[model samples]
Target chain A: MPRPNLAPPDAAPLREALRGIRFLLRRGGATVADTLTLDALPDPAAGLAKRMIREVEGLARSVDEAASAAAKGVLGGHDNPAEKLDEIVGHSSAAAEFGRAIYTALDAVLRRIGVDDAFISEMSARAVFAAWRQDHPHGQPQDWAADLTLRLLAARVIRGAVPAGSGSIGRVEPVAVFAVLLWLQSDRSESENEAVLEAAADIALARATEIAATIGSGDQGRIAALYRKYVDHV
Target chain B: MSKVRLTPDGLPPTNEPLRVAVRRLRWFKAAFLKHAEEMGAELGSRFEVDDTKLAAAFTRWLDAIELQRPADKSQRRAFFEFAAALMMRELTVDMPLKAVGEPSRAQTGSAAAFWPEGYCCTLFCLSVHAAATAQEFHADTTIDPAIDDLRHWWSFKENTIRDASFSAGFLQMLLGSQPNWVMPDVFRAKPRG
Candidate 1:
């Protein structure tokens, strides 16, 4: 018999592992938390864990600030004390004009992605945004461009379970999903096809759980078992 | 499904370290300025400023970081992104628009509605992706590596917009029986009972 290609789930980067530990500690000292604590391990890779922690902390701060600033910038709000003064003195038009400039830049980006077509819709955009918000409850969940594009495309593609029509930019190839996730990850360098597929699988798992819960499972025992396994592994 | 609203009131009290850090930072800033003015006032007023106060401010800022989560990289990225976005705002606030004409009110409103959350979220997502991906390829990426240089060229953003905070209870409600965390799953060695 052929042996299964069972490799250990690649250990997340040391910093990522440390981040996972810190987050668990912050949440609650559950079984999972106890299972993942960094201090208990006698592993030689201690530095890896420490770096992971630092990396996560650093990323958290950046994401929070960037998300907030980007949100505010495009929202037409005053930038700072100086800008506020400009607004108070009837420079509101100036602020509005500045917003327009940013909008134009954003529009250019959108056009480059070829989402300037009729395949997108506000409802689809809202759905994607809602899904993201649901997942990332604590951190910022706003990505207007991606959200808008995904929804528009998802609606066009997901007309049936088989994904009937072509997506916004035309045919929805598996690689397109990879590209989308890469863009979502803000990575443009190497197209790691495998990683993107993993991400899609993760999404599918989450969506499956939601649908099962809502549809009223006839096999409650099986549902409970599945949820336990998911919560245990994922 | 409908949106779940999270208000600040719903959140638990602020972490003690965070509160201490904020208070200490505020105190350090005030003391530094007073000391500077006192020393400077004697000479050119600015020349006699207290170096001690300046040192204290630096210490306080570091202390704030030390007191924050031991491993919250996203927090740091968010701060930088926030700063970068703010800089970008300053750069473009007085720029000219080349669109055919002014945007419609609805379009403008829609854009405004999307900017704040979208910018912050996107920046956070991007930075995390970059950092995490880089770490995966190399075993030894710096915890606080030369991300700033990348941000400078990549156009990082810092938020200047005011956003409403969700209540702490939001998570509690969502988790009901179990809390959801933005973390990867990892196994910890079990403690002896």
Candidate 2:
């Protein structure tokens, strides 16, 4: 039987929620956590904050549900969801753009919720590693591309820099992230190439984060050059 | 009756070196030929068996198997039989299906001849070879002789043996084998009682 197209439906709700959260973050004069605590306040702003918080949480849940459904479709072989996803997002499979989209959306929500970028990056890296360890208890760092891509994504998140092609940090399929994580966790031996790649990812992420911070996120040429420096070295 | 005492796992009661057991299993050639004929008959125009290449592939496969410690004493006989049946099916059935594109309904229907065990064994072997070859490619390590031979045979048949779903399934199976394996060593030899 011809497989059904399993592309996720329109994400208007998610987009709307992200916009609402971003607006609240900029204008509310309160951190995301502060907004959540508005019930304790007797001021008029408390009522508005309460309503906005509910809307933002509802939208975030909707995005999570959509991402989970897309992930299931990819795993179930309903279709080449990755290809459909790539078409929707317009990026290469290796770029892991689908995962970027999900991450980007979640990051937006988290940022508005008073979560710092460092914590987000650390958690994301740990989560990827945990998933990798679960799938491949003995797997070694075998695939260089997967390892490099993961480190790149992690670093981008740490710096709060947008992904190259996408205007946002971008979300990705968890399975794709998991696949890369498995490769990263595989072969923990400090072989020369493995050592070099590991170092390269670390050095690259740090340097990229620094460059993004100093020059601002809009310096695409410098950002590209910074990434290329590591890519070339590795 | 044969002097080789049979065990519960359908293997000889006493352990023998793989070479000795393989030498003793004189039926290997005959069994292989028999299965080859059956599979060829089933595949009809889509099948072609290259005896020289098939023998080479079998020897390479056997070499890899022999390196591993057997799980059961009776495993030698069972493994030899299993390998022969697997090679025969690959040479005739699966290879042809891959080569001629997806099988026709008539061809799919004919697969009733394959028992579930036989199908699993064939898939397991193919998955092992595929995984080994892919690892070799990534690591730039010398390819296994069996995988190299299989790749040559695949090329000869104009078949692309690397299917994504097949590789993913193989990875899942490989994960199941865990730290105990360097390759997808699914079939273990039975230990002697």
Candidate 3:
């Protein structure tokens, strides 16, 4: 028996469609996650759930747009759009799998936070995007890790974990967290200046983590003890 | 303004053009005289007066200015300031003045007036002016200056020349050289040592 040819007759349109889908998913996921994480949610678990739902919805919308464009291209007798349509249709199962994974993660996080709600009400993509737009009026994407670090700090404040007037963590605290995240994320080609920033971040992170642990235990004295280790660092 | 003509051989004219002379004299009175007085006060007996050599250097510089023929009022003023600065350096910094001779009227010029060796004087003069201008513009008297900060500022403006020089000879002299210059920051904090 002769081996069947694996190559599709028209591959260019399918490639274009896949490229568009990849860009849409990456940018959409990052934007949604950053937006939801930074917004003033009732709880951290709720924010993470909202972010997951919005990301899936965003991916689905992009897939629909791609399908529509491919159908129009086929009808107009343009470069073979049926090939692209088929590729997108074939990926529908994968998209569904991504949505299931997001739901599973949300469930796990909510359970850890002592929320056992079986059904999580999904938020509309428009609502989440609108909140993001309102927060960033200039339409610039929020730096995700920096926003996450700040939200974590704000969460600690909201929980009354740290004393209100202690003045232990000041404005520089967020910068320190951002630096550590950047340093960890950096590759081997990092410059000496960046290495210095990373080292400083390490020092700051050590102090911050200690403070966070103390706050978690609800021990004000321990929090003070950890903060005193680096009173002169900042 | 008179239309100053360059010699057919491209050697500077033996006589200074009337417009250049007037500009040079004004610069001498306005900036040179004031700076000379300050130098006299600073280095009382050590400041030596070489009247002939000084006049000769002034004329050579004026010829250089005339050859360059700055396009507008601003450029003309800049040249005048540069000339004044050059004279100030010549008087105070002990820069050897270039000797000027009578113009070679012959098509084949006399050897002495053809190519003068005081091109270094021009480079030193321009460098000093650059240092002075950088000092005037960037020197923050309000903040307590640090030695590191001052060194950074100086290094930043090391190669910058404020006025244009027509002579390749002068630019060649300045190509790789760094001048030892200082700005007086009276309010500077004492160094850590």
TM-scores of all candidate predictions against the true structure: 0.16, 0.21, 0.18
Alpha-carbon runs more than 4 Å astray in model 2: A1-234, B1-26, B71-160, B163-183, B186-193
lDDT at position A15, candidate 3:
37
Worst 10 residues of 3 chain A by lDDT: A77-86
- Cα distance off (Å), candidate 1, residue B89: 48
Please tell me the interface RMSD, in Å, for model 1.
Answer: 21.8
lDDT of each: 0.29, 0.34, 0.33
* Docking class of predicted structure 1: incorrect
For residues B1-193, what per-residue lDDT tens digits would candidate 2 score against the true structure? Answer: 2111111122222243323333221222323344434443443423333333343334434444545536776565434433433343333333322223222322232222222222223433433333333333332112223322334333322321432123222222222222112222234422223
> Which lDDT tens digits does candidate 3 get at residues A130-200?
34334642311123323333433443311111212433344333333333323322222222323223233
Task: State the lDDT at A178 in candidate 1.
Answer: 23
* lDDT agreement of model 3 with the native: 0.33
Better of 2 and 3 by lDDT: 2
Q: Cα deviation of B115 in candidate 1 (Å)?
A: 54
Question: Any runs in candidate 1 off by more than 4 Å, and if so which?
Answer: A1-142, A153-155, A163-183, A186-188, A211-234, B1-193
Could you tell me the lDDT of residue B81 within candidate 3?
A: 38
Candidate with best lDDT = 2
User: Which should have the higher lDDT, number 1 or number 3?
Assistant: 3
Tens-place lDDT per residue, model 1, B1-193, is 2121112121122223322322232222333233323323322213222222332323333333334323545355333322222222321222111122222221233321223222222222233223333333332212222222323212222222221111111111112212122210110111112
